[model samples]
Target: MTENMNDQLDASATFSIELTCPIGLENVLENELHELGLTNTRLGEAQVKLTCDLRGIYLACLWSRVATRVMLPLTHFNMDSADDLYQGVKSIEWSDHLSVHSTIAIDCHGTNKEIRNTQFGALKTKDAIADYFVEKSGQRPNVEKQQPDVRIAVRVKREKVTVSLDLSGDSLHKRGYRQQGGMAPLKENLAAGMLLRAGWSKNSQFSQLVDPMCGSGTFLVEAALISLNIAPGLRRQYWGFKGWKQHDHRLWQQLQDFAKNERVSVDDLTVTFQGTDREQKAIAAARENIKRAGLTGIVEVSLSAFQEHDFSWQGSTPLVIVNPPYGERLGDEMALISLYSQLGYWVTENALGGVCALLTSNDQLARQVPIRPEKHTRILNGGLECRFYLFPVVEGSIKRGDRQQAVMSQGAQMFANRLQKNVKKFKKWLAADKVSCYRVYDADMPEYAVAIDMYDDWAHVQEYQAPKSVDEEKARVRLMEIVTAIPSALNIPETNVVVKHRQRQSGKQQYEKVATSQHEMIVQEHGCDFIVNLKDYLDTGLFLDHRPVRKYIQDNANGVRFLNLFCYTASASVHAGQGGARSTLSVDMSNTYVDWARRNIELNEFSDRDHGVVRADCFEWLRKSTNEFDFIFMDPPTFSNSKKMSNVLDIQRDHVELIDLAMARLSDGGQLVFSNNYRRFVLDSELSERYVVKDITAQTLDPDFQRNNRIHQCWVFQKRG
Candidate 1:
């Protein structure tokens, strides 16, 4: 039987109530119910069932920040068919629970094969209740869909229907504070759950919270509310019990008044919250939301990047939380890998005694975080399965079998020693020449047979494909040892090191990709930027051997219209753009390479209209293009057999035809610089009849490649004058 809203009740009387929450947070909700004085509580799947009085139910609805709904059960009965459901619901004391003047609604769940339609079941239950009320009085209570006074809930599971009255309307998760949450914002309740799982509570003496990647300040506002002892439901105006026929309005008002009184009154508090972001719009939205939450100046927010965030706070270790960008559409595991690894590295190096939690839905990317997770909790963020990587901000205690315990073999030791000696020898030279990208070791020891190039702080290791006579097992062991030795010796993490196999190619095999790491980065050469991918292609977009070649073009490209053939990444055209060239054109056979060239130019703040990247074979393009140039930098591949090309290109056999085709488009006094890497390429002697050729191969050799002058060859040509 049910009582009226203002009906007096025994303070000690307890009733059956069920609390529903997110699946993984049942334990948290259980503890919360215990704190609210609910007795004999038991956890069931995504719910907690307890025995509590009307006041207990009111407090559960008013104080619970994690629970979604609070429901009070009326009865449990078997229902085999629709009539059984209707009769079972009608058997309950309808007058005790509803008034003919109050509006009502029924929410049905589950389905029996006999009564498969939920709406149909709900309609029958509604009829049973309305008819009972109409018979008791002259008219029936009206059915209201928007907000009913008495909300009925019937759940069917295993042919047993449990009828309950919902006491929390529109879900208790909505705190009514958010107005401008940014893209993919984390729900307020989920954010609070994350804080609780990360060992946060208002009872703590002193605490601080910082979300460096805060999108809309959900976490910060939740933290502020928690620290202030403010109940989540204190500000809400309506609930499921407000308009009920037997609603305990006085009891609900008492609960609300009690919760309001529990809020921390002191304006100045010890607890603090801060947030930082890279987007100005996100920061603005977060500010507006914070103001809506009445935490305007309490929670500090600024536009700061995680890279520049200060991990050190004034007092004890603060909790650092981050939700890095992730999704399937965001291509390349490399970016997320690098980002997580960087975040982990920063935590290890900076926040020694602090606590950090990272929430992400990616497992492969989670492995990329350098430090191991101490505790992982699975939760839902907007229905996406995500995990909280909880760990202390300290260096891991190295396990014996982990990478930290790797011991070098004799072969690897010798290889590492040689690399160290080479680095030592070129350290001063690289600095003097302003070289941030260079080949540190080019097989100085024949047995190692590997070329190591350093781009800024990262090392790219290329192993020569061994001959058939070499033992495969022995080579494999040696390569593993080398990988272990390189990162350890260079004092960089293993994630920063990329490995590749270098071998002699047949036809166009060298241009293909082995893996799609998409680990692209920008390296500065002569004050200009070029994109390089360490894992995507055999050749990292920029050619370190062409350092001097680009410098030469930049020096002579002033006020000239430039054209680049076989412009792999437009590194040379970027130099031409830097040299005040009015406009430029570049041609390539691969669309991938053309896109790479466009990114390189844009990265250096150059427009793509004047410096356009065209995807076309130079052979076909040189014959068709009417665009004339005052300067031409033509560096063709030694050989190519692309199926997309009209004809195969072999530099040694077809140098004359390619040069003749290039010379036709050049202005009379313009310079034509031709380069190739074919070790035995011989310029045709007959070409001296039409133009004067000057071999600048020796002059264009930068200091880095002087030891192997055969790495490339170059020639400058001009029309006979």
Candidate 2:
């Protein structure tokens, strides 16, 4: 334990302090105290008992945000009844903490009690203190509830009463910036606590911070203040110690001077903090709150929808903290789901080396984002069960070769061993089920879990487990053995086996370039060819998950004019054109990708007269093009707020509008296919009346990615004749 010279105790000074914290957060508080090297600590229900002279109390008050109140514990005694409570209160030496001329007040609450009434307990305790003073000094202190010199509190829990003096006059949550309220304003202390728990620190030069859904700017404001070493309680006008008889004026002045000197100017730090909200009124309120905190110049607030903004951080790794809508209220669930899906799209498109901390109560919405978070912490906000998920953004597209295959190879071995044992049990279970494709047993047992999908003579088996360490070569070999054993266990020959090793990528390095090429033309699985340029990217091939949809296009196309909106590589259009379409037009914003789409059409041997690639915004192109098409494919990014596009695109929320636009260009009896990658997609119920909607997820899922249904629903909507 490191002793603070300033916090040295004097034997002549005798004092007891009571620290109050949130009920369930006592463990967190205790760990903090332990880290601070505070000695002789005792934990009670929502409180910690520590004895220190004046210096310890000051240190605790200055640094501990979790402590609701720092108190001087005057007495602790058994109080079985009202009479006992009154007698116990009278026995305390009140003169030590309160002057005869000062006003006093009593507050009391009971937990497990013989005296169940809190009002009766407060009145009895007040009487005992008042009568004792009157009898001894011939005068009693006035009871001032609003503003008291010495506030005494009695807490009765489980047949025990502990009396203490409140050192903090008001709740510690009043950090003093919020003069007016906005929608869903988070408590100041709770916000600070959340940031601290997330391991954010001033030492790290994280210059950029953004809160896309900044409701009341709680996260942004706190981040700024903490980075600048600003005292959270400096703006407050009162402390509970002001009324105490032994309140040291010299010590208080010294502490204030230290706090002022330690304060760092926000301008001195290269910190960029901004918050945005869709509601103009909320943005205005956040601006006002930022100004009140004396951080107007350091923090910026804007009226912007989350899906319509592109976040660019100029630092090494930016931190984005967002508390999105949780859909607790009716009519908000659908909107929130749409918002979350769009948020995921934005994260995948932009945000490199940046970390995102998304706070959400819905686990389903959290899964809508394609990438899984590295860590998650369960927290409570106003009785709502929420999780703070942390994801680290890599620089480029993720590839199998970019990852350390050694680790994955080892991980695969362990996964294979687990698969072997599960295959034996699954074979027995398969005999009972009449349906061959149905799920046999789906259970995750930490280190090992298996899911087997049987199709005809062939079965696709996937095994999941934690990745292996760098030097675990033996584990890798053992994993291969286990994988080989699975076939034998299932009564299949080793010659009929196909094995794959999958490694988890590190968040920061997941997207590095693996294969180098300026441009490459590759044949698709179905014999059609598509061209991709990988000079500036790691991925030059098709996303295999969309194989089913491409096949759908090829099977249905014949003498039809096909329109592909938001076409990235134009793979679908090439397939449509190869399927004997009269002509195909592909629209995309990226000129680089538009060229690649043109190459794909040429690679597939589709004549120039039958295919055309347009470099323009898809939505705008769709609105202006008068040419009608018999077939249309609209597979826009799940969410995008790019500068090139005026309106943000959210598949779940804007699908109806997008379908309407596509329908305008569809000839009578023309079919429009809409697809998205949001894992937990929900179609708008109103669309059922306009066009036939169907969930083609089961049909679209490829064998390579079997754990979850990655690609969303593919609905075919035909224009009414």
Candidate 3:
């Protein structure tokens, strides 16, 4: 009888099968296999190995929503070369698996030193299959790429070759009904996994599922498919085993009929699903996919914005699950925080006891929602670390209060006392100098390593970088306490305090934006008006430490032509204009800041005067200028490689050339004020020899900054006439 190979298709035929899924989904995939009756399931890296009968394999291919592929092992052998691979594969009975007329395709992965290219291995395997069929029947099957009748998967790892038949032609996530994928579409299986994680099932207690911001209806469609017991694979027209000679048509037909009988009518289902979007195009795509799945009557899609979603449900309030678009820029997230807060408010007002799950990549923006998440499940979505946050609303919520207490650790009280003491110490200087912005506290306490600068009534607190040896939780507590206690000590509102992470910064890093609240306030310093963007950048436009230097410029600028180089937002120019300089010119490389300088000049009515702002690199602008200045305030960055500059500026290496250029532009007996934050900066010997140099950095420190004179260095170079 030759023990006919056709018997492997029988109900009891057991074979080694492998189910593959994306990383972090192995446990979920294993659980799915267990539900499908796969025996002896063992989890591997991104794969699950199990023993299943032919019927079990069929069921797995037809029902697995999370698996990428179902593979039936054909043969495995030790191999070190392409010839060994061909010989190993040729031994398999090609006639038993494929007919001469059927086409085949090989997908090869992994490699050794000798076979580094996957295509080379695939070609060798394909040659072996074709040669075996030709040797048996004098004709070989043709190789087809798109929708091949038989798909062979080959993996070469650690000098061993594994060859198998891919039972699913394409990745199982491509459930053919997904005809319209919106921007950044979540894969169908991933959507199903999300729903499963959300505890949605045939016996779910929740009566309705609503995706108010649903894009393309993947989540709603997956929910509908799960409730209706419709096999997602049934939408596809072909299976890898259907063309094989060993396939049992009658058994597959029976399995199909069983799956068909398991399908429940939409009217008889306990759960209902609805998807909505503000974009009509997205809604149209959802309808197309729903129609393709033949669930047009079961699932509903509509054009509605989150704002337009009124609490107009018929029965119970649905669990609101949403995936909002997070823009791909720094300041872009600022706008979405209000939108998320609106979402939280909507869920709280409409569904008091219901659940809301939000998926966000930014924790800062999540905090703005004002609804504290009880559960934060970490998931890797397309390699971006994401959190599926679950929040439950209740009356008189105190969970957030508990979280605040927990976050503010034992050192909170000690940090608060340190801030109060610093406020008392700096109180006299703040009023005596008429200073609205000054560093009141700079690391006064060891536990709270933060610097607090006051801009009018607003407090800008910068948390210094903690050491690696310090406990992260302890450091977090210190930061929380510093932010929490600053407003109380300063008599300012909590919202008026701006907190930012402080590290050693230079060049454009200082200009990198943090938030976009546009909380600009005009603060007075020495009777000069300067606009401060407290929420936008690491630095406000006004530098509190440089108060004395700006004061020096203001006190000596009468009837003088003042030049402000590297004029970042032109705070120094504003001081010059306030000091009544006869004419003023401000030059900077950033067009954004040059425009800002223009705005500050307009604020003080300096624009109608002789003062003007120029957008140009100071280095290039100084070289071409024919005008000489009586007072030139040159404050170049430590180093910058901005694309706006033709040459990279390294203050230490280029200070000689920079000094020479500035000295050449100085009028007779004119003083060119050069300053930098480089702690170890040295005055150029040639410039000191050619001109009179006075180190004014010591005298440039205001009473508030007298403790840290190294914050900036100032040297006055006057032309020797």
Residue 19's lDDT within candidate 3 is 90
Greater lDDT among 1 and 2 belongs to: 1
The local lDDT score (0 to 100) that residue 138 gets in candidate 1 is 68
lDDT of each: 0.78, 0.67, 0.78
Candidate 1 lDDT over 501-614, as tens digits, reads 787764457678767657788889888988899878887988888899999999999999999999988999999999989988988888778888898889988887789889
Per-prediction TM-score: 0.66, 0.52, 0.69
Better of 1 and 3 by TM-score: 3
- On residues 198-254, what C-alpha lDDT tens digit does candidate 3 reach at each position? 767666667788887888998889888888888878777878888776577888888
Q: For candidate 2, lDDT tens digit of each residue in 1-721?
A: 1111212224456565778775545655665556456666889877788766676676667656567788766667775667887788887767766777888878887755567788888888889888888888988888889768878888887767878788887777677887755667777766766666655656654658888889778888888877887767677787788887677889977877787787786557876887788877788888888989888878887888766765555776777778887866322342243356556556655566777778788875675454557778776677787887877766432221311121134554455455556556556544543223333223333433444433332333334443555334443344343333344334543222222222333322223443232434344446576554323343343555677788789888989999999887889997897788899999988766787788888877887786988888778887787888999998877677666677766677887888888898989888888887776777788888887666666877544344456535677887544
TM-score of 3: 0.69
lDDT: the better of candidates 1 and 3: 1
Q: In candidate 2, which residue pairs clash?
A: 169-240, 396-511, 413-479
Best by lDDT: 1
